[model samples]
Target: MARDRKPVKSKGGRPSREQAAEINGRILSAATTLFLKRGVDGTSLEAIAAAAQIGKPTLYARYPDKSALFAAVIRAQVDAAMPPITGVAETATPAARLRQVGRAVIEGAMKPVPLGLMRLYIAEAPRHGALIREVDRLGRQAALEAIAGALAGAGGADAIDRAHVVAAHFLDMVFVPHQMRALLGDVPDEADPLHPTLDARIETAIAAFKTMHLLPAE
Candidate 1:
């Protein structure tokens, strides 16, 4: 019988790509849980390392400080929540695709983890304005990219040029209002007959956009 060969490790004893990804996921997950439970000011790098079952040196090696780690966490969250450029079906009309994009934005914002982080961010904004802006830029950039992709079928350079303007209007008209209500603890309740659910809000916004000629033609 042939002898079983031992698995070869990466050069210089470094972790493999899969291992590195797993370690990063664990670290982010631990940090997110702890931060949500205790707030960013109350959480420490050492605690995060312990919760992740990794050494402090490893955590420090990846992130020099708590702020750096927090930013990484935010980036991961935003990346997960934001839809990719190819998320919408190409067969759909530009207006219908835009509606899908809007729905994605609202649903992503209302997810448990992102919602928790939003509350924490608002509470910590005064003291951590720079850090907040950094992550806020990450999310806004992703949102704009997704919005622009949805508008790509509208026209030529004009459509691309006006993408930023359209993105701003879309967020202001569809997203910001609902996000404010959510931030203020006004969540949708199916049992409550008066509650304005996200889908209903999206439909209303899409109709309004059509009436205002804001949405592009198929």
Candidate 2:
């Protein structure tokens, strides 16, 4: 029998933050291309790893499974399209707040990637309806939260329920028609023709929120 040997060293060390980020970027880029090209069901982890030029372990380490990876991709897609929302002063008027959030929503919905993704969601919804619903809920979450926060601030503590109601109304009023048009390929590729309508809807939503949440009862 041979003498005991030293323990085998680990094959690789942990990657630096920058390396991890770059690997994640590659995985997501590959996943996005495959998912869009083949639909969610047709894409596979192996394909994503191969396309990304990384090992299967690396892909799994970052995302446990396809749904998680799909969600990450979807979230990134929406975040890329959506405008960056920074903090606004608490004392800002409700109209100003509404306008700020409203502009972001409109601009985000107008992005080309969303339009294609919307169409894909609709096409795949029959079989993957629940997943599609989850994606939509997440995609709209930031906008809804921002709107709710502004409404809550203006409406005060007692009006939280009414604030949610106002936020829902604002979303429906501003997004429904324009988003539907975009999804159906009715909107032009170059510009959003709904800009004027968005402005009108913002004022309307603000007025409604004020009356329903902010104003004193007569």
Candidate 3:
């Protein structure tokens, strides 16, 4: 007797670029929520996959491991919070650029996810020294370069020193206080309590940087 042939199953439609982006967005959203709720150590790949409603293999395909995913999320948050430095000009004066950069930094730090990630980084520092060092190295390099560029463009030959001081002081004023409060679980119920107001903080930081001789005299 001849055996009956089974019908062939059709392959699923290929995901387009937009579809892929949507998937990535879902994964990132899930990761952000999970990371914030559970901390890095408590979160797992399976949990992320389940939360995102995708298979574990899909998550791995996009990010090889948990650390990579976490890093991507942090970078995304930072990019969103900070404005790009495209319009900065060599003729804008060092103080102007410094103010712009300072504003971006303050805005970036005050973002909810970024702030949460910063807290996580600090808490994990004791055990994950390498991760902390990596983050610091990248962050410091970006800040130093931007500050140095602004100072050099506006402050002439003394730009390097001035940039260093500005970078340090800006971080101290714009980020350190709020960062400490968040780390200590002292963030107020109000939205953006860490930053309070961006314009005010930026103005305050610029003033301080000028007072410290980190910016060219007007």
- Which window of 10 residues has the lowest lDDT sum in candidate 3? 1-10
Per-residue lDDT of 1-218 in model 2, one digit per residue for the tens?
Answer: 11212223345756666667777888889898888889889998989988888878778888999978987887788667666667866777656766777777777877776777777778878866787888788767766776667646756666666656666777787777768866665643434445335566676656766676552322
Overall local distance difference test of candidate 1: 0.77
TM-score of 3: 0.66
Instruction: Give the range of the ten consecutive residues with the poorest summed lDDT in model 1.
Output: 1-10
lDDT against the true structure, per candidate, is 0.77, 0.72, 0.70
Candidate 1 lDDT at 192 equals 62
In model 2, the worst 10-residue window by lDDT is 1-10
Give per-model TM-scores. 0.82, 0.70, 0.66
| Tens-place lDDT digits, model 1, residues 1-218 | 11212234579677788777777888999999999999988998888988888888778889999988888887788888774555577678766777778787777888888889888887878978987888888887888777876766555787776666667777876687778788888877766644577777677666776676766544
Error of 1 at 22 (Å): 2.4
Residue 140, model 2: lDDT of 73
Quote the positional error of residue 14 for candidate 3 in Å.
Answer: 6.5
**Best candidate (score: lDDT):** 1
lDDT of 1 at 178: 77
